[model samples]
Target: MSLTAGGPRRDDFFKVPGKGAGAPVKPGEKAPVDRTAALSVGAFQPVVAAVPMPQRLFEHERERAAARAAGEDATRQLKNVGADVDVALTTAVLLLRGVEHPKARERVVGAVPQLAEAADYRPLDAAADFLGLDHEDAAEILEELTEHGVAGPIAEAAVRVEELRAQVQQADHEQLDELLEFLLPVSALISIAGAAAPLGALTEGDPHLAEAAKAGVVGLAAVALQELHSTEHPNVELESTELLEALTPPVR
Candidate 1:
């Protein structure tokens, strides 16, 4: 009944090896690997960084935006809160006197839009009537005010200035230089008087104006970078570097 020396019919001695759905390997042979079994399939998950973003950038932008908004709110408050007539009128008188007083310039630049709208005044026309000046002169003044972030009336004034400059055809750069020099203090004052956003309004609008504003912005940026490098203003140094990078011309 036995085949060879041992009997094969005993349930205890008979071993049935377990294998996957494929063919089973003999005792002396290596089992064939099911690659599919070894492999895993599910949703593809791309490797991503678990690293956090630098907090400096977010903080810097937030602070700058807040400062700008506060400056805007302050301007609105000036309009809403009725000011003392004597003090306000005295301030207006000082502006018309044509001296480069920083406070006077700030007040005038801010009120320009309101005054112009109320009087239905075209800036070039108003300047010519009041100061006996032409279009080139008016545009120069508009540029000055715009550089200080006195935007709305400043923009309106700029339109009239452009009209006048167009009529003249020829411009006087000498006058523009003179005006810029006189108004530089006012521009600086306005920037400092408000929040910490750099005097950005100077570079707003066209490439031409941006070019003109570049020198001042660059100079200030350089100083800021220097100061920040020495101290801790959170992201001041980083922001300075970003400013420089932004100001750099792109490669063709």
Candidate 2:
């Protein structure tokens, strides 16, 4: 951006000689100019009408008023458990629509707690943590995917995570860690599975296993490697399926 002088331009400061002014004087004397008779004109005028605010500011104030009303309505609805349910559903719909607009998203995020309270919906603290990590990780993955290409499941998973994060408001530390541990392994496994499905050679002799191993897919890859070995790599098979059988979701 170019730097502009602090005040009015040179054209604005230049004063023209007016009628009934004194005669032009020599070097030491004053010029014959009528100061009082001068009409000053600026090079540029303020295009905006001073009385009315900018269109965006006006709309912002209007939206703020609507958001305030919505908050009050939410508070009132929350007092009645039955009504709160309806309000929560309505808020969810609004939030889904508003996600396309950042300002609207901000408004909806601010109202989430009130909506939950009004609806008597138990706020899952764990869900909040999930949202925060999901947002950060998804943003990173998006940046990576921009470079890596969006042809695979990893890209799709990142998109899904981004969508989920947009809905959150109150994520704290402990809940976030739990969510990360739950999500990473599962999503990494899914991504590897997706990578392995097409053009088998491109993914290596065992595309699924290779992708899983590449993504560090916990022990799920090992189980999948064992199960599918007979079809694709009969020479390398699991000694026992007991490890796969014992795998269970961790108790929360």
Output the number of the TM-score-best candidate: 1
Ten contiguous residues minimizing lDDT sum, candidate 1: 43-52
Assess candidate 1 and give its lDDT.
Answer: 0.27
Misplaced by over 4 Å in model 2 are 1-163, 167-170, 194-252
TM per prediction:
0.18, 0.17
Please identify model 1 stretches exceeding 4 Å from their true place: 1-98, 116-119, 129-132, 149-252
- The lDDT of each candidate is 0.27, 0.24
The best candidate in terms of lDDT = 1
Mind sharing the TM-score for model 2?
0.17
lDDT of 2 by residue, 1-252 (tens): 001111112221111222112334457844432211222222101211111111222233234335445564332222222122222222222222222244423443343333224322211221212122223333333233223321123322322223223211112322222322222222222222222122112323333222212222212222222221111111111211211112211111
TM-score of predicted model 1? 0.18
